[model samples]
Target: MSAPSRPADWDPRASQVLADPIAAYDHMRRTCPVAHSDYLHHSVFRHADVMGIVLDHHTYGNAASRHLSVPNGMDPPEHTAWRRMIEPYFDGARVAAFAPACREIAAALVGALPQQAPVELMSALAHPFAVQVQCAFMGWPQALHQPLLQWVQARNAATLSADPRALAAVATGFDSTIRHLLQERRDAGNAAPDDITTALLRETIHGRPLAEEEIVSILRNWTVGELGSIASSVGIIAWYLAAHPALQSRLRRKPTLLRAANDEILRIHAPLTCNRRVPTRDVTLGGRHIAAGERLTLVWAAANRDEAVFGDPDECRLDRDPALNLLYGAGIHACPGAALARLELEAVIAALLAATASIEPAGSRPTPAVYPAGGHRQVELLLRPAAGS
Candidate 1:
């Protein structure tokens, strides 16, 4: 292909798609599922198209960014090695063991919030819920929350060119933190209940102990992926529940609803819009030819809303089959921490619902989620006590 052809009318760089992208995703799925963008270097929007590339790892190599996602961007054998090193950290048993800690963190954070109304859900709830759990998992000190939060916020801002300096600060802090963690773990001989840091320090890569650079990449991926994605996702869930008080009450009444609620949230508000892939060679998908080195956008948000795969694609019904949701992503790059993320979300939601009588919109600041993804990210709300609730 000489140059990727974009749909004539749409401007991929426009902010509206990043403001409330579901409409755009809906449009793309129906009109140009296998569409390309002249500016975007050939993006893929349909569910099947993205899935084909994601599942067939050989044809579409990952390795997009070397620093943060390490193996998330790599292909098979190399990918498999890194994946194996961290797999034990995300296993069923690992999640099972983490349940208690997750619940404790949730209950503590929820219980500690002042009874004052109009709490900014980001600072008061979502941020804490995500950070505390991550800290607990990594065996890091809770005192690190403030600076860590700042670093993460700065990093996200940098990604959007919202704040270049902020991004630099985040990187510096992150690098320092990684160095400290590695040194601390090494000094302690890296014994663990089996978290990623512990697993890495003890394990070897390619028959050699992992170097500092490799370890830094692993930590960078963890911090970047966890901080924004989890925080943004938590805010999304809370905003949804806060709007639908009935659903909030339902979760409060039945703790078991936590898991399904998580699934529903993932389907409803997929925060990560499009993940990129580089075509290995000439490949035809949905009548579109993808040449080598062309960038393909895997519209995860679009796929979840696909009418062919999901009925009432625009609705947020919690009763849908959880397995069908592609919110975490698909194929090799599908989230390994999805189980852990769900557990954390479930615990926090259950606790918040159980404690508050009802959630009301105190106030929510409107900010667009990242693209080729969109939605409101910051939502402020009041958790009013339900009568006899």
Candidate 2:
């Protein structure tokens, strides 16, 4: 039999894994069943084990710490309570209403693009969409848009840093911006045109309205969800289609596949590679013992590629079932605004396809690079525009 594995301090594949993770995932699932995560946390790489922790609420609690992720960290009881407070604000009605606004925003951003060759889609397209949509919903000042982008980027880049100082700085900046937005929302009576900020201000939790801190936490969650995750997904979509002309054509013909495509994008290289979890008590997962307070990486990248769960995890299939991908996650913590994100991405992809017959790589575009911590790098797409368009 092979020797027992020693727990590692950090995941060595942290950076390489981000750049092109599926390769790393194959090795991890086989070798390191549960080692110290790249960030000195413990990591669980197998499919069944991740599902076990994700599905088992009692053993693996979500109430780790809000500073890490306000919504993602709150465990049961508190989690449901806080979620109940925020649920109405993110209801389908508001999400659907925002569709028109989101579509317009996508069109306007892409339309504003210069006919000039080599325009980077991330800077000009995805980044702006994420910033505008998020800040608009929060009733935040537009000037803070770029700052939010940088702050969220740092959040993704935290593990790569020698120290956590970078993450701290991003959090500080984000908290400051959130404070300003919360105060403004309060002063404005939490009212915006058919948006979340208004609902946040007006809603009551149990008996009383949510506190400014709670509002801030909600907005913080919004930024991470929109700015960091969606932006990365946008780049992934662009990179994939840019590389695969046939896939782009298929999408052009089968517009309905946009939802499936979005799921595929999220599954392939999710921005949040692994979420941290501290076990409530001793438990066995994947035949290995996991002690309490032993940090573990719920490695989504590996989970997405699990041979047991998704046969042929390496190949990207547009016709693939959307229900299978763990990109939005599962259980109570499933992203509430998933519908809105899909709408925005669909609108953007559809509009891009409608506008250009063809797109190609170009210089001056931000090269789509993935550092260990940061997600998608926006690269310039130099194009001669599709034949007639």
Candidate 3:
């Protein structure tokens, strides 16, 4: 089959787009909802179009990567099996049980913040919170925090470089880390610490225990999903609140609104920019025809902010329908860790609010993260502790 016979719509890696993804995507959605590019082939920008593709997984397959991606890279049946095993880990009881640790981590980080001083939120709080929560959840030690953080940054760099060698090295590096942890559990046998990592070792598929490769894939997926997204989300949330003191004050006064506010803020400035897909057959989408085997990128940053659906993409409203928000995505492939993610985010924001009387932007603007990653690279904010705390 031949590729589309059209000039590229726009470059995704353009300097302007990387500088401000939301604005760039807003333009693409209006100008070319279904657009083509060298980097991201056919890009879908409308909410309706993205939802259509997401729901019809048969036509738009999830096997976009050359490497194994556990359930994420698999379709139904295969995906269904892995998902069933995975969902139990993030069930209501488990998520509820994990809340205290999450809150404790958040509170400790907040306590350590310098009182009423300009601090880089990404390094000072965001990254640490993500690392600690992930470690606590998987029952890993505190020593692994910095290594895991470094891994995430390197992985992001490899992805942006689009160099196969670089990307392969990053994947191998992560597998080594996870493999070592897995071996520790194996060495312990019956006395394996009792945590998520150990629980995964006990899981079986089709009456046989999962292979080392499968376990590595599963853990890799979880680590990537949790580490990068959570940290980016933290930075985005703090940046938003710092820029909008009125909304910050309101959320602080009404603690229950943190969940809704967090979702809204992320939707406005997505922490994860896009997810990939490939066509199983030749099909037309958003007025553009894509050939079979062609790659497609779902621009969540654009779709979530699509004006047709949200009226104003930038408007943060607590009353919007939760079903419409694609922050964790939609359909069969929706994020399994979504419940835990929400709990951690809400817990952190609530703790920060409770501890601080005000969170305002430090004089300088933040450095926005580039493609393949979302949110600010370094968000500076002045945090004032509550009186007598």
Candidate 4:
């Protein structure tokens, strides 16, 4: 257990933070680039500090969780091997092949939307799109979609409550679900459907088949990434476009810009809040002394918007240096599913723009999602259909 070395610098769970996290984080970055809080331990809010920590994996390790997290919770040598095995899963060919189905899912969901009426985009479009696309990609049964979504919600709630027992229960439940799927595949032998889930079953590391726990851990990480992060991203992008009619019109005019535009929009409003790291040895950061083995929180929502790195953090400039944007993260543990994520976001956004003449916000104000989640929890929008179709 790493205790706070000094008086706390901020409270992450304060009402102000819960209400508008980006604004709160912006304030923190400007006032206290590195802050200490009981909830988040030591948070690094600056881009330079965050970039340094991510790049130096040896000094700042990623084994932050007690449970197995596969590559997400691993450090090099072990992380390198797992990463090598995981990279091929998200390769260009695989992502490209999945593009059509992804787009199909997007188009179908968009078509189902009520045109020119108040629609809660999160529930109507974002959540379902994430669930359907993730299930389709993994070859999971449609029956599991609702259950999987419920599980994600439970997990997020448990995380916010910071209850160990609840967290463990949800974790066990998810592991059981994955185990059941794996068992079905095992029983079928060669008859199992050819999908990412089945392919993972045959994958080996160090010449031995991946352990059941390892596979479960990998799937769990992927599920959270898809269900939580991707879903939040869709809502954020839609809300941004709805709020900014000029940018929305520009994107609709130039469809080719959707890819970069999505990245920029997400950068301005991060869908994922923070990632964890623990220092391997004593290090001083932001003029504060952080003892070795203490917890470190990299606030991606803040770092990506650091004024030192990005002048006028809120401004979305397509011409900004891509390398400076930490949307997909950087270094060893950078999101392995980035390619797939990009494909899914672009397809869905393009589908929404093509199907809708314009997307405008409903009269009601959007509610920001609390910590452990990103983007708006409730975003009501009026999606007008195109003239012809």
Candidate 5:
């Protein structure tokens, strides 16, 4: 792939960008909609540009990663087969069946929070909720919770470092852990507990059983989405509510709106930052020529908040069209696990609101997470208990 001759438009790792990534991305959207940088290669910031890329998968391919990524990394016929196979795992029936367990977990976590006292929401509620709910969904033991949490932290650290060796090591470790779980299910035979993990063992593609590597890859992707993105989303939602008391009270009184409200809040402040795509042929985007085979980063954080698409990106309005929200993305690779994610987010947020009379920011200012992660890293809040309960 030929590198762009134009000088770097902005440093993604600059001190200012790291300190406030959302504001930095907003600035980039206005100044350099299509930016070239050594780190991301080329980034598409505007909504229209990103939509064009995702929709034209033939021109912009999803198979940008060096490693196998199941449906997320596959293109066309191959992606079609894998995507068809995985979609049913999160179909309405399965998500509905898991709702009771999800609510139970969410309520228990909320009940445990200290009333009328300062709490670090991420550690106290967000991370643990993500880990516990994920473990419950996969039928993994509670023992894996702490280990999985640690692994997520390590993975994020390695990603930020941009060290290939560290990335490889983290990948290998996660693969090993997943392979062990698969082996245990195989050993149990019909005696194995019925769960998503076991269900994947029985899945086949093109009339053949899924390869061990494929199974591991699927689980790895699901785990990352569940643990990392879900955790970040929880923090973001809670922080937003605490900062906006009127919206918080409105949501508390009318719980049915939580679904759309959660989607809009996450749209304003994205959880997953970007997804990768590579051009199959040379293409012009945002008046910039991107060479064939060059990498493209679709900045969801910037694109969803583009002024041309959503007026006043920061405004929390529920009337806006849902199709325009890029929170879960669009086109073929649009997050297959979106249904499950929505169910999980709504359950947790509903539980939090039902249990607390009000959620207010504490003394310490919340710390925003840097690149490779979205939302606040540390959010201190005071959760006041509801009357008589």
Candidate 6:
């Protein structure tokens, strides 16, 4: 056996790719489904190939990160155990319980939007809504919202920079913030509120109590998912609707169709771009031979928009099979918080549509986000509130 050659198929961080990742990924899926680069190492862009990697965990390991990531970065049976414990949090009962709070948060934000004027949706609505919902869900103090938002920005910057030292520092900062909250709950003891954070304190693994680090890791993952994907998703869905008046009008009229409509819109413009996986054994995919131990980046943004699977990648059809969309990913490592994410997104979008008569792009065009981040950096829209209430 010989080691496969590592050639630069394309520069993932190139200016053109960063400028518009959705278009860049579309090109990659067609031209080089499986390409190699120094930055991402091996990038997988096709639908079927990515499905194969995620489904078969034995050949594709999830322990890509050196730090602990609970179930997300862990392989079974460890991953399985963590996943089981975490699933209950997003169970039907819990999700239903939080629906009222989520809707209230969404409604309040939408109501505050400037009517018939230019407003940056990300800052005014998306980011605040994301952080507020997360904080409410976890029973965290409202005071943490600003700090949490700041942390998300710093973490995203560190990831994009690809500086190992900077990434570590950012991780430590997040851990510290989480640790303080945990300590506060501990200090309060019986007086602490019976919330999710407090509930985690009572959980155990394999007959032993979970370590402080483990609890922090679990919450960190949830925080990142809520803050990043949920916020980005809001921007993408709103931006798409603003651009397409017909679809926007359709969702507003139907209202019940917001969930499927959201999934379809995000499919067209992904909120989270990629996820990492390492090969436990040598494998050949999409006509490219990848060596064992080499890192592979599953370009979800590309896979979800694959022409082979979606017919026309750009077309938005709510009736398309939901199984094909990789917005929350697939297989064992699929997003555990997907239910909660859907609830949050649906609440926000529904509120926006209900509160607004129309939403259209305002002043300058949206500034697209770069690698490691999807959706827009800044999305400005002029909103018109619905008649009466």
- lDDT for each of the candidates? 0.74, 0.71, 0.90, 0.92, 0.91, 0.90
Question: Alpha carbon lDDT of residue 250, candidate 1?
Answer: 78
Clashing pairs in 6: none
TM-score of 6: 0.96
Which 10 successive residues of model 3 have the least lDDT summed? Answer: 152-161
Estimate candidate 3's alpha-carbon lDDT, on a 0 to 1 scale: 0.90
Model 4 C-alpha lDDT per residue in residues 17-92, reported as the tens digit of each score: 8888999999999999999987899999999999999999999999999888999999989999999999998999
The better candidate by lDDT, 1 or 2, is 1
For each candidate, give its TM-score against the true structure. Answer: 0.89, 0.87, 0.96, 0.97, 0.97, 0.96
For 190-307, candidate 6 gives per-residue lDDT tens digits of: 9999999999998999988889999999999999778988999999999899999999988877888899999999998999999999999999998877778889999999999988
Deviating ranges (above 4 Å) for candidate 3: 1-6, 156-164
Whole-structure CA lDDT of model 4: 0.92
Name the weakest run of 10 consecutive residues (lDDT summed) in model 6: 363-372
Q: Which stretches of candidate 4 lie over 4 Å from their true place?
A: 1-5, 156-164
Model 5 agreement with the true structure over 299-329: per-residue lDDT tens digits: 9999999999998999999888999999998
Candidates 3 and 5, the one with greater lDDT: 5
TM-score of predicted model 2?
0.87
lDDT of 1 by residue, 1-389 (tens): 59544554355666776656777777877887776666565666666776677788888888665455677777888888888887777889989998999999898888876554777777777777777788888777778888787775666567677555766776877888888878877777735445567767766988898888778877777766776677777777778877777777777777776787777776766767778888888988778776788777777788877777677775767678665677777677778888888888788877877777777777644576665334455677877764564
Best by lDDT: 4
TM-score of 4: 0.97
Off by over 4 Å in 2: 1-6, 13-19, 66-69, 146-163, 188-195, 363-374, 386-388
Residues 1-389 of candidate 3: C-alpha lDDT, one tens digit per residue = 99446798899988898777788899999989999988888899999999999999999999999898898999888898989888999899999999999999999998899977889888888888999999999999999999987887787677767788998898789899999999999999999998999989999987899999999999988887898899999999998998998899899788889999999999999999999989899999977778898999998988999888999788899999999999999999999999999999998888889898999888777777878788888888999889888
